[model samples]
Target: MADDQSLITILEDSREIRDLLTETLQHEGFDTLSFARATEFERNMRGLKPDVCIIDLGLPDRDGLSVVNTVASNSGAAVLIISGRSNTQDKIVGLELGADDYITKPFEIAEVVARVKALLRRKAPKAEATLSKIVRFNGWTADLEQHLLTSDDGKVERLSFAEGQVLRVFLSKPNRLITRDQILDDLSNGESDNFDRTIDVRISRLRAKLHDDPNNPKVIKTIYGAGYIFIAQVG
Candidate 1:
């Protein structure tokens, strides 16, 4: 609810589905614009930038994946694909191309609304969770704005949105023990709790990107039986 009147663009060819989605989103206090073709959506995007765009693959003009790639590359809008294709491969392709979330057809309108809200929450800026645009720790610089990490030797590592968020949480409380629950709560907007494994996985991935050895890490240290401690001195 950061912006109660946040605009949402819907790009589904099915008239019935489009009407239902427009009604459901409007009921949730969102402003919506529906399009049956990708060309129309792209044309209007020049005039109006939406907070979130719901795209379907079965477009009359072009493949929706192309739209997802183009929008992600050019704009900061959150993209969600609602499609009838339920294949896991198709979903993966959509996500890999930068769609925030994917929902297969025959979905509940309530779930669609919930997913849109969740995506918006991710896009919204959390003032407290943010760090300086750039933070340096032990010869490594994390450019939070660019989502890139530069090592002392000038080796650059790219960060996914989730990775950047986890790194921000660590940098916000440098050298402090941060519980898994705290990390999960911060990232999940307090809507989830069973994230022990998820947190571990993200931490492991971050460590790998930071080149921190698991056995004797210098940056992020695991406090066995408690939580993680960012060993870096943030500046």
Candidate 2:
């Protein structure tokens, strides 16, 4: 209803839950559109792209995951899946398919609000945030918004969602040792499994993309028993 506010679209079949979410988001200064069916959401979303889309997996018309995949690919709106499915595999599938965050149902309203704000923080681009959009170091450029890295020689490398998240964390705390636990915690919303080895693999992949030598990497240095540090000047 509020045109000037950040638009948030909520898709839930339950009237009570839908109303509650719409009311909560409106109270939080977000303009919201509520849809009781996936088809309604799909059709309306074509004309009005919201800043965020809160999707419930139990839609009556269509599979919510399909909707999530579609929205993730077609819309710039951040997707947050709210489903009763708490299985790790389900969450992982949602994330891998491009959902930004996933939360189980019967969740605390406060937590929902918190996660919503967090997603908005990640999506909303400010001047200070723009500094993070393009990070250059060691002849490689990381574009957070575009999710691509460009080398000085004009070679472009596309980054996965998880990779982009990792790069963002590193850019935010440049020159500081970021522990594996910290990375897991920072990326907990996206990562379904909280395993240390997962972070190690991701870091290894990122280093490879940066062309850092595995034997003696300089850009992302492993701190023995502590963590990894982004040893580059991020401007």
Candidate 3:
């Protein structure tokens, strides 16, 4: 594809879901950027270059569709709409605005990863989507070397130690599945117990904060007998 190291930006508002998705994306080997507002998203689009963008239509400060339009006008990155809205008109408008795909609410996490791989594959298919050292998911952007997540408005979200660590793992690998065992092990730093339902608890909080439905689930999916997956996109 682009280079097997494409940079993908995640324009989401929730820190908990952000951490989980970032971890999962990094695990499969792709660069990642994360943001929470329109200002930051616009700023980053002007400054940084991303390959694919996953825009969350719901934002506290502004509607994410505006960011998508702005990014499409300014950058050549592939655009993917990640929205809680499942209306046909919304999807048509987003795609007409230049989004490559539209993912509805309450989607499976595995499906998200699959869409990411497909988006990355647009550059060229080699089975891995072949990230070119960076990944652009939505209109939002991230600069791995600088370790900063920014938007088109110039606002920046500096990641913390743990957040960055989690982001790194997800961006490092794209489309690769992650399990709860792996999540708990990584998050616990090796210290876990019988009552260590910390991972599930964190995921639940994240789902709420990210506006993901627990019953239907959008951004993350339970693997039934396995664990969970980050559904960063839908086909």
TM, every model: 0.64, 0.62, 0.51
lDDT (Cα, tens digit) per residue for candidate 2, span 78-179: 788899999988887777666777889889998887877877765545345446577887788888776788999999876655567778888888898898
- What tens digits encode model 3's per-residue C-alpha lDDT throughout 1-235? 3244688889888776667667778877878888887788788777787877888888999988887776654465767788888887787666545465678777777677778776555433235433333444333355543445565566665432223334444454435677667754543334223113334544554454345689998556777878766655211
Candidate 1 per-residue lDDT over residues 114-186, each given as its tens digit: 8889877875668665467889998899987666889999998876555666788898888889987787777
Segments of candidate 1 deviating more than 4 angstroms: 130-235
Return the top candidate by lDDT: 1
Error of 1 at 35 (Å): 1.1
RMSD of each: 5.2, 5.3, 17.8
Instruction: For model 1, give the RMSD to the true fold.
Output: 5.2
Q: Is candidate 1 or candidate 2 better by lDDT?
A: 1
CA lDDT, every model vs. true structure: 0.80, 0.79, 0.61
Off by over 4 Å in 2: 1-4, 37-49, 70-77, 121-132, 137-141, 145-163, 172-177, 184-226, 229-235
User: Using alpha carbons, what is the TM-score of model 2?
Assistant: 0.62
